[model samples]
Target: MEAATLFPARAIRLRRDATIRAGQGGPVIALADASLQLPGLPSRICALLESLACRDVPEADVQQDLAADGMPGLLRWQALVTKLDSAGLIERSVLTPQGPVARLRQAAVGRGPGSAVRAPAQVKLSRFTAIRAAGGKLVAERPGGHAHVELETAVTGVLAALAGWTSAGDGVAGLSPQLSRAVIDLFAGAGLLAPGSPDDDTEYTDAALAQWSQADLWLHATSRGTRLTSGYGGSYPLAGRFPPLPAVRPALPGPRVELPRPDLEVTAKADPPLTEVLETRRSIRAHDPAAPITLGQLGELLYRSARIRRVFPCADGQEAADRPYPAGGAAHELEIYPLITRCEGAPPGLWHYAAADHALEHVADPGPATAALVMGARAASIMAADPQVVLIVTARFGRVMWKYNAIGYSLVLKHVGVLYQTIYLVAAAMGLAVCGLGGGDAADFAAASGLAYHAEGSVGELVIGTPASESASESGGNR
Candidate 1:
């Protein structure tokens, strides 16, 4: 065992509540905010722990102090130290060029141990920003609002160096030993720094799975359930003021072709019942490329599934629109882009469906890559031939993020799911084939559409066409 020292973990505090009745047990001394709990200990034991928590103590000094106080046997002290180490209350120090870097035993923000400590390696800073709190104290908050640690703003330069803003020669070279250790300890506790070699692979390569980053997952988890803060739940006047409804994005500039859709009141009589459609909804992959989907069928599908039904006015002079499907904050952030391969009366191209105008805005001619993507979708669905149309559901993330703070991206994904079901049901009722894709390359979509990946990117893809005669016959009773 290498010589080690122990220091109190971030945010940990001892709470000694009112004493229990004589027969019940000893007074409960709770160790709060650590990775694990230490409770129901005697007063003497609590006092010993409290003393240890005050400052960093070397292992030899700790044992000497314990012996001087007539604390207990060495085995008992060792057991307590083990428990503290397991709970991430102990940070091991490793010597580095800057000074000693404190490494946490467990995480403060993300899934793994906060940060590894490798000698002679530059600390990798996470996406944590420093904010000034009351009394002129600086607090660094981890990404996704998970954890925070307070430190002196004077150490900002050190943090910047960790983030690779400063030259390696100057990086941590002038930082005092005490300040460097404190900054490293504080950053580790907040999960703002990680240990990584210069040659380490830091990029998350699994783009599909990495879409929902650790920060995203953390915000999604913490912002749900009870309405604890203004930024969460159905609480009105979020962050002190009710957010004005976002202006609907103007239809993209292109050749616009209006769609013909029957009024719902009139179509209600001719359309299949809702219950019947629900029961018959099946993801049909086998489509009859021979029988291409008509333009009228595509128009009806869009109008029935996504068109804006009504706009409700607010007292603040802003308006909220309701679509055929439910949306968080009544923000219809999703835009439909059709990748046409073989639709009747529609040329092979990329077109944007404008729900508000009930029109298709021709964006661009589908390049070979875009056509290949469509073919890939067809192959994934196990289809013998390509579908007439592939609907790429892209979301304008800003529309949702404008109002909701933490869980905005999560709500966008939920809206995508809701729209998928709506498309499925409408397709079933119309006797058309539809298959929702599991995942897609956002970069590919961006390349094809000339849209920024972050602003407007594909979330869901649904291939639609007329079903094969044999397949339709097999699904006859349900249909």
Candidate 2:
């Protein structure tokens, strides 16, 4: 494509967040930690990007700006555009004769070939694409999308047109032909547009896409694959808007059962080797009903696996703490609730493990909802009988959310997995049975514990108990 068509109407510009600096190479474009060098760039081109540093420049004007140095027009100009595109530093505004319509930018660290569309054919919004109003602008993105766009609500008609498989040209709805095409191109470049029926290999029949539900794919992409412009890792997006959640949830008013702490120094020396713990770890579904896990054993397990080691001050006067298992940002957002059905010394009830205190607080009497949660665990396990206890893991979401955006919940789940591994290893070392439940009924758990579902809800579940002696023979089946 020629420069005029590639950067229509001088709509290309340096992203507001980007900076240009003189470097060992010709010039460097820096945004966040990303940097792109232009070793052989014409000096005229370098000045052009510098002029764009503090403001927007129409792409069509790029050559005109270059002409000041007597180096205007194609080859040299196109080379700079290619380098900027590779650096993910270009932001383009789509212009109609009357006004600017929308802007396209890179949301992820890399780029792709963009979505495909057969000319004069049916095109539709990809099932993974989500369009929503944010901060008075319409933001569109798809799972793992690298390209992102923000547009005024005026072009919402374009989205309405592509809501389903409509003719490609039909996508032109509320704007001039050029503006409408530009909007379509923005969505298409972001992989939010898909070839609809009558185009070979529709997204509906894509085997890889078929395996991903919208939520799963969204989580997977937002957490790992994509770097959203919204930000990542300790960004503290909510600092001024909302106060951070307490690093340690305040004590719930209830009868506290002070648990005994294990002698860590002695155990560290005498506990089974790491390899033995790793090898012997098994999800013992058959917990011994006759010989239930004891209060002392439960205390030791919690102390070894989840107790807080220290607390320290962090950004915005927020507190952060360390625990036996690793957590993203050391937020230690997870709170453990033990559902005791047959622990010998402790009463059968729902209890919250206070990590800071190394004690159990009886939160509620065993009720129908509690029984249902226990049953849910048993159903998930390959048990000889109901396990001795079920552990519900929850996150005080704001603990992570206050510090991170776009990937907060993802960090919470990862923290849960690490906590699960810690518990499994500790239980195995103690010759106790422990199994991590894949999932649980969050609504049921909230009802039983009387905790708010959104603020604090179950994110993971596990069962723990004394392994039935004979059931050890069936370990293979459980594994």
Candidate 3:
């Protein structure tokens, strides 16, 4: 047989305790890190194996030691080594530098150094969890899968060491080469070991990092289906209780005016086809200052696009109701507040669109800054005049938050996109002009709307008006 050398892989620990009783077969020893319970070994054999834990020993010397200790000698030694190798706990070879260093050299020269140099085997425990079970058995669990392996309670120390409770040097100090190899192999199979380092630098931009708060990022990460553990992907009752539905805030007690509900069937037949509308949709910035959009037109737009077509309680006892646009869990949490700058029939002011009753509830007079913002958008759009109405889309986060967890914000943004597209399509069909703003300052919106920044914040904005025929022609075709 060829000569062999042995060394302990990192983070393998062996423990002997009263719990490890000697049965009819042999004394049982637990390999904690590997979650293995090894039985069938005589007292002499156990003693012989323990002696090899502290340092490297030649194959011949190990065989001699086993024979001297009144054990089955080389045959037993070879069998144990094979078992450990399969278990991933020990290393047997003329070792050399590997891992990161090897990867670097390989990348630079297309090949790594030959197998002449010698080095100690290095191993680290991968992230995992071990839990005690009802029957005194231990269970080892790792991310990404539902499978778990059973282990002996006595070997818990080995798992703890692999979990980083102790340094690699300390954990593997006295572990037999075979035992160490078994632990490594078990963890590697289960993907419970550290991943290999990449040769390239991986970093994120400062702006990208700053865009999302740490808590926000954590919520997004945990809520995603890909990152979530099993039994966490589907919607579940929060704390085993459904929260009460927020009573539709009755049109902020102000000057309330009923809106005209235009006949939907008549409008659909009269308007251009869906395909034509979609193709013709454009962000028209220029408005006819002399002929602002009629108040009736504004009311019709809101009615067709955002008005609650119907409202019914959800079957699951969750405080959710279905609406025109698809919302996560049917939670129609978006609220519209129109800021009119130059409507023909409506006074220039901030008005909330009451969806339940389909009415405009005057909230407040538009501040100078709000008016300036509207005019600035018109100028940016190269419009002849300011838009007739600037719609501020705000989200009532609590409605969705009570039903969803980490994915709540992401869902809200998606709803905003849906609403934006709905508005674009509806405006195109109505032969009206519309522009969706890329972003708006939430703080500025809060100050103008007098709404709390946290509970209800602006998520999007859109400008709408009657496009000047001459200016529209000058702007050329759809863009």
Off by over 4 Å in 2: 1-10, 18-76, 108-121, 171-179, 195-199, 202-206, 225-230, 240-246, 263-274, 314-317, 382-385, 477-479
lDDT of 2 by residue, 209-260 (tens): 7777888988888777535535756678888888877777799896999998
What lDDT score goes with residue 453 in model 1? 92
Q: Candidates' lDDT values, in order? A: 0.63, 0.77, 0.59
Residues 246-362 of candidate 3: C-alpha lDDT, one tens digit per residue: 526545876987888899889978999888887767777767777888888998999888887666676655555555677777778899988898887788988899887889998
Worst 10 residues of 1 by lDDT: 1-10
What's model 2's lDDT at 80? 68
Could you say which candidate leads in lDDT? Answer: 2
Question: How much is 193 displaced in model 2, in angstroms?
Answer: 2.1
How far in Å is the alpha carbon of 224 misplaced in model 3? 3.5
Error of 2 at 56 (Å): 7.3
Judge candidate 3 at residue 201 and give its lDDT: 12
